[model samples]
Target chain A: MIKLKANGRERVWFYAFLSPWIIGFLAFTIVPMLTSVYYSFYKIHVFNMNVVEPTFVGFKNFKYIFEDRLFLKSIGNTFTYAIIRVPVGIIVSLLVAVLLNRKMPGTKLFRTLIYLPAMIPIVGSTIVWRQLFSNDFSLLNFLIGNIGLGPVKWSSYDNAMGSVLLMSIWCGIGPSMIILLAALQNVPVSQMEAAELDGANAVQKFFHIVVPMLSPTLFYLLITGIIGALQAYAEMSLLQMPGDSTTTMTMVVVQNMYRMDGYGIGYSSAMSWFIFFVVGLITVVFFRVTNKFVYYEG
Target chain B: MLKTENKQKRALPLVRTKKTRKLIGDIVCFAVALILSCILIIPFLWMLICSVQPESSLIFMNPPVWPDPIRLVNYKEVFFEIEMPLLFKNTMIIVVSNMVIGIAASISVAYAFARNRTREKNIFFSVLLATMMLPWVVTLVPQYIIYNKINWLGTMLPLIAPSIGGSAFFIFMFRQFLMAIPKDLDEAALIDGCGRLGILIRILLPQCMPIIATMIIFSFNGSWSDYVGPSIYLTDPDQYTLSIGLSKYLVANSVTPWHRVMAGCVLFSLPMIVVIFTCQKAFTRGIVASGLKV
Candidate 1:
């Protein structure tokens, strides 16, 4: 190896460049991650908003998760939402991308409209959806009344989960749509043209050429979607009202921490790790499946 | 000559048939896309109406398709009655501070990772990617404990410090952008007696304004919408950002009047929507460019 003339000085600047993240990780992320592992064994109480030195309970917190009814329900809710939302979100977004792929009039306008909702802050969108799903006074009720259907209590047991699922689908489709649109554009026009010349119809061309080319993007979105859906805390927390019949989410931790005035910080920490594990497992599964099918155009 | 004539003769009818088929396809695609886009955008349309209408007009058996007598009172109330101005200032303080640090740190480390070939580089890079998979929620309690021991709780330190450490995601993004740049530029800068820092500050940064802009936008949006961090750390009413403030508005108005609460939410979310619409081209480009590597 050739020695650089400015080797000593270069090292100083390199360390300087690296310090922010290094310092940050040591101070913030790594410290917190390790601390949380410790906290998973302790019981915490919020006395006057000051956390008392957590009582070391050992594996009690982990055991609580298995025993608690709400804890088990939350796990089921999280997985069910992910399983339902991920594939549906992917399929809808992919379909939208395919529709927007062609050079039709006002296509750009439609694309913009499609992507607009992804920009709205989660809390903001949830508030709007709340009003739309209001039992006594909702635009949905009005629309349904016109068709002679009874007004539905959207947040009730019969519909609450489905309503949230629909909202999830609406909010997520935009980003995936844009990604798929880009992927579609990257597909070779020559290949499509050659297929047409060989007397392949539109469906044949799409199924054989477009779908294969779009798989990598589909896979990427699928993994990220799973990760995102697993972390579905914000909308659920916001949508939930006091005394509401619905309960589906990671928001139970936040709700317990904030509203219940009971601080089982250790139990919450255990729950959080469980969510992380599920997400990690899903991500691994996605990688395994996608490795077989995703066509790397690059 | 016969081949050319036969091709032309066949192409003429095919062109006519193709146009007819394409038109039908366009109509079908347009209708489908229009309906889906409407589904996606309905929340936003409702939000705009919620912000402008009177609290009374907002709550009806059948919500009005259009706001009647268009009460512009909510915006006034949000500014005067609610301490939204203070909330905006608080959010800006956190956003600006972190944006500066995140960009500086991410760009520098990204440059190092992109150009340098140290022995530990691969190990460090994989570790960085691995960290991305660790959900923030898992770290929440532990980080809180650490912060508690250090007595940094109830301050913005908990919120801002992690960002200064180059975010794995942003670092990855910047590295990818830097990789796209020609290496000759760095070599030329080095030949002219520019040190790595000098090259980073002088030559490379100037060429990376688009990416810098992208980083700033995402950082701003992230900080702006971030409720979980500040909420966990800052329990003081004065310390709350817009996100926490919006949530509080809902909780407080759970029974009082949802119209006013929605109005506040609409006002709170306006910045995000406006930013997105204006900079969507850059937004999509930035995300796509960053995601290409992942």
Candidate 2:
């Protein structure tokens, strides 16, 4: 390896080459992150683009976030959504991964098909899904109708949340499945054979061998999944109707940022920050809990 | 003697049980796999069906799961009504340009991080890693404000220019892939009087095909799907990409037709689908090999 010596002036070129990202991050991401924390304490007016000199209103925004009805509802909605979606998404992917791992005919075609949803842009896919779940003529309602069931108002108040969740799972299954499938491939074939030789049935082998060995990949997926679920706003934005059902808390914050204008901006930032903290905390906790279970062969 | 012979026959069958078990295993696996495949393909099949159906017939009280008479008009309507071709062109420019810039910048920077053992390089690379953990939503407004002030908001500058530095995740990916490559090639090139740039371009670049292909597809897919950036930056309707254009269609009115939206989606997603199918293995391997730490 021909290593370059980091002499006094050579450091300048190194710094220069790295300037694009460093400057951008500091100015855009870092500064904004810090400012958001700062602004969470004060009121912000989107119209004026001023923070109202940040009157030292400590925890008021946070307090309001907890007390507000929509905010509270959103918190409940978000938690329920994440809790259900994360596991379902993981399970669906795992199932797909396992099936694809088998020496079956058309495995290649199945793999390609599984990855199709990820290739579709989020907005476009959401649009497609929205139409499929449309109240008047959704593909879903059509399918349901065939079974002699009433067409559910999928995008309406009660059904809308479920619709969004379904959409998320559909779009998310592909990438997670792809990653898990790759991980499955990395599992040693010898382990399976050894179990078989030891008189282990397929069920016993899966539980005793496959599941334990696959835990690390599973842990990784969980961490990434939580991070993703917390930041999920695309489907909500696309599926949200004019009146109400689509109004999850994240959407509320974004709507405040876009439509509600000014009074709620500070509060919204605080709420989103709370989400960030919660997500980060959940991820750390997951790692802590699953660390013991994660098996590393090497 | 007859009883002894019968006992021997039973023992022989028991000893040959592995072959029977193998046959059962294959049959079971095939049966289970077919069911799983059907579940996975349902959505895509629905999408195909929806894309071809006429708008009027799209939402019947008891609509057919499959299109009875395909309407080619939905595709035509998407092109004419939504100006999908223009959006495709617009998105392609951003996607292609950004991919080139991102790849160039990432390869060089990743090479430095993976191979160059300089103090400054280490710190700089660490900074890059740290940035990846920070959420982009935090900085989105600031970036938009900066771009707006710089008079690059409506143009593709804000969308394209920032990619020249490459993404943190992509940089990390390339670095990992580069790390796995043998260092002796670089040593040999150095002995031949090849400069660092020449070694990178002629030697490293060729061997880095899979990673490069991954980067290209990823960048294309990311930029193509990017809605938030374009929705925020591009105020002009005519400048909308497929993402923004599709969003406009969906959010326009309560009575948006399902068939047209599906057709538009199918049309918009063709590029990515085509690219992914063509380089499926490379894409999967690139992600798995690069993402996992040794």
Q: Which candidate wins on DockQ?
A: 1
Residues B103-126 of candidate 2: C-alpha lDDT, one tens digit per residue: 777876777676664576866765
lDDT tens readout by residue for model 2, A179-279: 55545544556667778789899779878877776676676667666666666666677665546553454533453443245566677677767666666
> In model 1, how large is the Cα lDDT of residue B154?
80
lDDT of 2 at A217: 62
Model 2 chain A: worst 10 consecutive residues (lDDT sum): A251-260
Q: Residue A292 lDDT in model 1?
A: 82
Off by over 4 Å in 1: A1-23, A104-109, A118-127, A134-138, A147-153, A181-216, A241-261, B1-24, B57-66, B80-93, B96-135, B141-158, B166-220, B231-241, B244-261, B282-294
* Residue pairs whose backbone atoms clash in candidate 1: A21-B165, A21-B166, A36-B142
Q: What is the lDDT of candidate 1?
A: 0.68
Candidate 1 on A20-138: residue-level lDDT in tens? 76787777777767666676788877565356877999888878777777667776777777789899999988878788877777676777677666556655665566766766666
In order, the candidates keep a fraction of the true contacts of 0.46, 0.19
Docking class of 2: acceptable
